[model samples]
Target: MNLFIGLLNMAIEKDNDRALYLVQKAEVLAEIELFYLLPHQRRWRSWFPEVIYCRVDVEKTRIYIKEAIKKGKWNMDDWPEMKHKILKLLSIDDAIIDLAV
Candidate 1:
């Protein structure tokens, strides 16, 4: 995650709030991913460290992702390949996968 934001920071103009905020959102989504995927993990030093212990509703998460995607002005084609694979592996619908990625 550090490397990703570091590269993005270096590639974009310095002190860019929009880019940084987008990265921050991405990091949160990543945390959400781990929260659902990992069953035995304890904690992570994030905004919500006790996410693993807290309830993680899959259907709610999916709806959350859908809502987020709808609200953002994101480039539809700029999704990472790993996102594609992850959503596909989880059996996400193709149309929703397009937005989630």
Candidate 2:
């Protein structure tokens, strides 16, 4: 976590567009993993609710989504649609969305 933040900070400090792009990509991937794990990880879920939420009606939503995706629930082309959902779930506010884009 510290390493990720350090790289992101360096990208911003240097104003390097390519590095910024890579950092953003890394951020998205990390957040997806967080989203997938948060449900089962009680400590993480308790720690992060103030920071973000997801579109779910009940528990195990993340697990179900992961299973579905693994079982051909979405095609490669469908990921573009889901990407925005993942971003929204990971974001704490409008500022986060702005930074991500």
CA-only RMSD, every prediction: 12.1, 14.8
**What TM-score would each prediction reach against the true structure?**
0.30, 0.27
Q: For candidate 1, lDDT tens digit of each residue in 1-101?
A: 69656656665566665545566656656656576556544344554453333344678656655665667633346666755664565466667646545
Off by over 4 Å in 1: 1-55, 73-79, 97-101
Q: Give the TM-score of candidate 2.
A: 0.27
Clashing pairs in 2: none
| TM-score, predicted candidate 1 vs. hidden true structure | 0.30
Q: Please give the CA lDDT of all the candidate structures.
A: 0.57, 0.53
lDDT of 2 by residue, 1-101 (tens): 67666767777677866535565755655675666565566356454443433334434554554444556563435566575575356442334334433
Task: Please list the residue runs of candidate 2 whose C-alpha ends up more than 4 Å from where it truly belongs after superposition.
Answer: 16-39, 42-101
